[model samples]
Target: MVDENQLRQWGTKVVDIEKQALENLYQYIDSSEFAQACQLILQCTGKVIVMGMGKSGHIGNKISATLASTGTPAFFVHPGEASHGDLGVLSENDIVLAISNSGEASEILTLIPVIKRMGLPLISVTGKPESSMAKLAQLHLCIEVPEEACPLGLAPTSSTTATLVMGDALAVALLQARGFTQDDFALSHPGGSLGRKLLLKVSDVMHKGDELPSVKHDICITEALYEISKKGLGMTAVVDSNNTLVGIFTDGDLRRVIDADVNLRTTSIADVMTQGCVTITENILAAEALKVMDTKSINGLVVINEQQQPVGALNMLDMVKAGVI
Candidate 1:
């Protein structure tokens, strides 16, 4: 029943309308009212409680999550639920961010007096600045869109997009003000790739003890090749008599020896090995190791301890498996 061409055209048109709607948010976010809202949230001693009804409630939930993840403590409470018993979640130290496109949602209006009684600061996000919800709140940020993307003009299209963008603007402004760092963001998202990159250390995902691919510096290239193959790291660490890393031999070294026509069975690894190779410490983050590998254009690294003793080994494969690459 659907024409593919018409459907494609409709999708493109909707995107254009919402894109323009987001573009229009620049003025509202730069307004003094937006600054006041950010100040109130930044100074709050307790959590931000976002309240809304229906579609507004959905956007409120997302806004609450974005704020919480970006160094602001916040959560969502439906206006209808607040009236029954959820208002217990509020306290004197808390601030309220209520969202209603029309600015006159009855459920939100009904909670205004209770919020005031609790001595909570109220911030309203609405399209109608003159509506009761905006007029009664202590701080108001307007999200007025030029037109809806819906052909029928009955659905919330551009207006909801504008509200979401405005919420993102507020969250980012607060994030910058607090100097929130990626490490702080990682604390809340430990299961994601960013967390792995930020939190995983070299010792946590490296081959240690007997698993380390190591050979004595005086060993023949053929013997070093056996160690590299057994350890499956495409390389081997060349250690001195005291088991301190003195050099490294890799597949690339093997290629150069072959090109020079040096017999693998007769040549000592020290003659062909690379001295003073790039190394990492056990306590450094895996991401730092990746950066070193990238800068040096290498695939593996030797992890050292405080006394410059080789304690572990890791390659790009380990970084990939740990989600750090």
Candidate 2:
């Protein structure tokens, strides 16, 4: 068992080692032909195929996912498997991204002949630019680090970090080049919170039809209060002459009116309603509506159409039910 002090010291030392390794990676970023490789991937009409061996293969899997999610279509292929028969999955139109620390991984080396025969564009990411794999590729993205974070200096640690970062750099470059939007990302991640944040709209959650707590401007505050209770929205919109929304009344206003002894039975809702109430459009995103509610310090809002007519209404509870809160 290690003492607390020993654990803390070891943690600190590891952090420092990794930090220095990352700093050394910046030199490779500046000098490497990363730009040329990005240009090649952007020009490719087919998917990008990332190939590697062992530890590099694991990093390649994550890289492929990041690329596909961001904007580039990419997949991971094991170089060892490719040598047997999986090379058929790749095509001349696809761009191959090969990753290796020493730049001489044997499994990866075996794919060079097959890749050459297929006439596919090759991009190699390696620490040694002069290694056989790097020399064979048309573009080389150097991911060199001065040393590994592993104390033994044999394990792939800092080098893998640099390779992953380089993969991210390429993905983001392609994402920007393609003008990918938040909606595009949402489409790809529909099951996650990212999709919820981007795809959830006010209309998707807002209560519609008779579920809206609303009253005619001439109705007494007592009747409006009854509507708020029935709709359970904690608020009610006040509409006028042509059924166009004119004002709103909330639970906060009820407390104020009670102090002044305003007659809920006799007073028209317009007399106690809040004029110029904030409203949102049906097409607006629920997250944006939540922001508006936060900024205005209100819990409920009326949903309006493009013509400025109330179409629906909702409160914080509705947002919670729709998982937009």
Candidate 3:
């Protein structure tokens, strides 16, 4: 039977070793080769083609995904698959980032000739700087770790962690160089919640048309309450005869009006409504709308068109449902 103490000790030892490897990554990023790698990807007009084998190949796939999502166009191609007709994806203008711990994988070494003949720029990421693959490539990035966390020094452990960190450093550096914005990142990640929060517009999540809670400014408070209740937005827009927004009446205002003993049946909405209430444009991001509501200390907002007419309505609940909160 596996001993609990031994299991915990091994787990802790592996994590501690990997942590040290990550701490050592700062030195790798501080090197000139790191900067050159970023510049190469930034200036290249073609896509970044990443290649590797075995465990290095798995890390390369993640690196490719990170680069692609963060504004760099990149894709991973297995070296073995490259030999089996996938090499057609390579172009003369593209940059090749080859990953290998030993820097001498047979599949990768064999492709060096084809890559060179095509005149593509080669960037090598490896543990051995003096390896043939490093010497053959135009640039070499060292992901050398002091030791593998594996007890047998066989399994990829610290070396893979260092490589992954180095890949992130390259991706983030390129992202900053390209001036990539959150909106740009959202466009690439539309299915995720962060993408929804950043890209969802007020018009996309707001209640419009008949769903908007609105009433005439001269309507009695009792009539405005009906509109707010029917629309279910907790507030109603008070519009003038011309259909222009005049004020907003909310549940909070109603509470205050009742406390003051105002006659709801006789009072016009204009009497108790808040004039010049916080408003937003229909095209603004929902995240921006959240900020507006937060800073104004309100729970709802009126979305207005260019003519300043209430076109839509939304509350904190709408934002919450849309993942903008």
Candidate 4:
């Protein structure tokens, strides 16, 4: 049986080791070689071709994805596959980013001569600066770590963490240099929740026309309650004779009326409604509207026009349905 305390200590030790590995990365990031790598990537006119072998390939794939998503076009290529005609993907304008912890992966080293023949710029990432791949590349970024976190010293642990962090540092530096924006990021990730939050607007999720729950300010409390129940938004906007917004009535107001023993049949909604309630414009982002709701401690909002006319209504449930909450 596994000892729980021993397993916990082992896991904690791995985390501590990786944490130190990341801290050691700061010195390399502050070096001139790091700036030169960023400048090379920034100046490249084509996609970044990232290549690696074994576990480094897995990390390389992730680094490539992050670079692509953050404005630097990049994709991972297996070093072994590149020798078998996959290298045809390369062009004169593209740059190669090679990753190997030891800087001596035979598969990658085998392709170095061919890469040199094509005159493509090569950037190598490795823990050993003196290794063949590092010495052969146009530039080398070191990710040296103190030691492997694996007790047996066979698994690539601290070194891999340092490599991944270095990749992130490069990607983020390029992202800032290119002035990448949230909208640009949303364009690349349109299918995710983050895309919905940044790109979706209040108009896309608001209920308008006949679907909007609204009642006249002079209407009786019972009639306003009926509007709220029929619309299923837990609240209704109170408008005047000209259809301009005056206030709002919600389930909370109904509860207050019940406690005061007010006559729902005779009381005008205007007398019991919440005046100057939270409102939003249709063009605002749904995420911004959520902020307004959260800041005001309310669950619903009335979308108004320049004339303060109730044009639409939305609630927390609507936000959830639209995946904005």
Candidate 5:
């Protein structure tokens, strides 16, 4: 039978070893070479072309993606493919970032001549500071780890983790240097939830025109209830004779009237409707609208124009459907 305690110990040991590896990474990050790399990327007008072999290639791909999304345009190019005519992608204005744990991947070394011929600055990321690839490059970012988390010292674990963290550090530092904002991030990820929360506006999700539930202030409670039911928004805007918003009546108001023993058939909505209720503009972000609803402890809001006319309406369900809740 498998020993459960042994398995737990092994897992804990791996985590501890990897943690130490990351701790060793701090010294490299504080080095002058790291600062030089950031400056090189910032000065380059072209994309960062990252190249690597095997496991390093996987980490390189993710690093490239992070750089691109964080405002530093970059993409990965396998060193093996570069030797097979993929080198055509290289431009004189581009910068090459090569990743190799040993800094001696033959595939990457083979492309050094062509990259040098193009006059592109090369940045190397490796565990060996004295290795050929590191010595050949204009700048080197060291990712040397004391030991591998793999018990056999063959599979890359701590090394890859350190490389990933280094790439993240570069991307974030550049992002801050460029003054990147949430709006800029939203532009790159418009389909994501954060994008929706930042970009979606009340006009994009609120029910407008005939879909809006509204009734005159003189309408009886029973009539207002029918409008609310027909609209399916659980509430109706109470408007004056000139079609300007006066108040709002909701299902909660109906319950209150019932508890008070009021005759819904005879009572006018204006008598029970909440006056000067919370309202929003169509141009405001849905996220901001959510904040307003939360602060007021309300479930819905009436959208009004400059003239105080009811233009649109939305509720918590609408916010949910819009992915803004």
Candidate 6:
């Protein structure tokens, strides 16, 4: 069994302590060393390598990902592995970001001499400015907090969160400096939802050429129904004798005609079809088309040309195929 009161208090205490740690980080942002550190990273010709051990290593990997996605070109390397062979990844043109709370991680300390020998720029993020990690590095970002969020004052919660946020700030600053756009973000994250939204186009998913269901305004209701079945879009465009769009017929209209006992063989599309149907231009984005369909409570749209003639068609299924859904 556990004390509910203690659990609740502990949760709140962690938030308060971590909040203060972040506030402290803000105060250190304007320090001259941060600017110098950013300049060193910005000027590096090779990739930025982030290295850490234990809890710091987890935060460092996320920082490395952020840097890479945001345009700084970075990757994480475990400090302990560098002693084996991973140190070969580092070169004279590269820069290293090493994070250690105590700034005295033995694995990291062991690599200091080799890193110096390679003459690679090293930046340190730590809680102790006086630790060996800070003394040996080219730049130091002190992330010290008076106490841990844990009641035991031993957990790495607040310190690790602060370091992670500081890493995010650095990555975003570089991203903005380089004017990295959403299009650029899509390049690396092509399998994700955001990439799908930015990379997909209307032409990639539209039913064009012979695949489009189309009927002239004077065409009989039976002919329109046949086109709908052949095209499998559940809808067909009704064009005038002059080859201009005038109306549309869908499954809903078929149901209404059946309920009215209208003769499908005798009734013309011009009379039974719904006039002034919702339409989308061929040039519009598929995302915009999706919004239009949603707002209009329609499942499909007739893609019309500049001459107001039916050129193509698409349904919600097309959006799914294009990855817009």
Model 1 spans > 4 angstroms off: 1-9, 255-267
Considering lDDT, which of the candidate structures 1 and 3 is the better prediction for this target?
A: 3
Better of 1 and 4 by TM-score: 1
Q: Which tens-of-lDDT digit does each residue in 1-325 have in candidate 6?
A: 8899998987999999999988888866678777788888899999999999999999999999999988899999998888999888987799999999989899999998988898999999999989998888899988887678987888898899889998998898888888999989988887887887777666666899999888888878999999999999999988888878899999998999999999989989899999989987877677888999899999999988788888889999988877788
TM-score (C-alpha) between model 1 and the true structure: 0.88
- Ranking according to lDDT, highest score first: 5, 3, 4, 1, 6, 2
In TM-score terms, candidate 5 sits at: 0.96
| 52 Cα displacement, candidate 1 (Å) | 1.9
Flag clash pairs in model 1. none
Using alpha carbons, what is the TM-score of model 6?
Answer: 0.88
Q: Name the regions of candidate 4 deviating beyond 4 angstroms.
A: 1-27, 191-193
lDDT by residue (1-325, candidate 5, tens digit) is 8799999999999999999999999999999999899999999999999998999999999999999998999999998988989889888899999999999999999999888888999999999999999999999999999999998999999999999999999999999999999999988888889999999999999999999999999989999999999999999999999999999999988899999999989999999999999999999999999999899999999999999999999999998999886
Model 3 CA deviation exceeding 4 Å by range = 1-6, 23-27, 257-264
> What are the lDDT figures for the candidates, one per model?
0.93, 0.88, 0.94, 0.93, 0.95, 0.89
Q: Which residue window of length 10 is worst by lDDT in model 3?
A: 20-29
Q: Which candidate is the best by TM-score?
A: 5
Over the stretch 151-204, how does candidate 1's per-residue lDDT look in tens digits?
Answer: 898888899899998899999999999999999999988999998999999989
Among residues 3 or more apart in sequence or in different chains, the pairs in candidate 3 whose N, CA or C atoms overlap within 3 Å are none
Better of 3 and 4 by TM-score: 3
Question: Which ranges in model 5 have alpha carbons more than 4 Å from their true place?
Answer: none
lDDT of 2 by residue, 1-325 (tens): 7799998987888778777877876766676477778888889999899998888999999999999999898999998788788888987699899999889999988888888888899999898989999999998888888788788899988888888988888888889989999999999998777788799888889899989877999989999999999999899988887768899999999999999999889999999999999999988899999999999999999987766678999898887777776
* TM-score winner, 1 or 3: 3
CA error at residue 204 for candidate 1, angstroms: 2.8
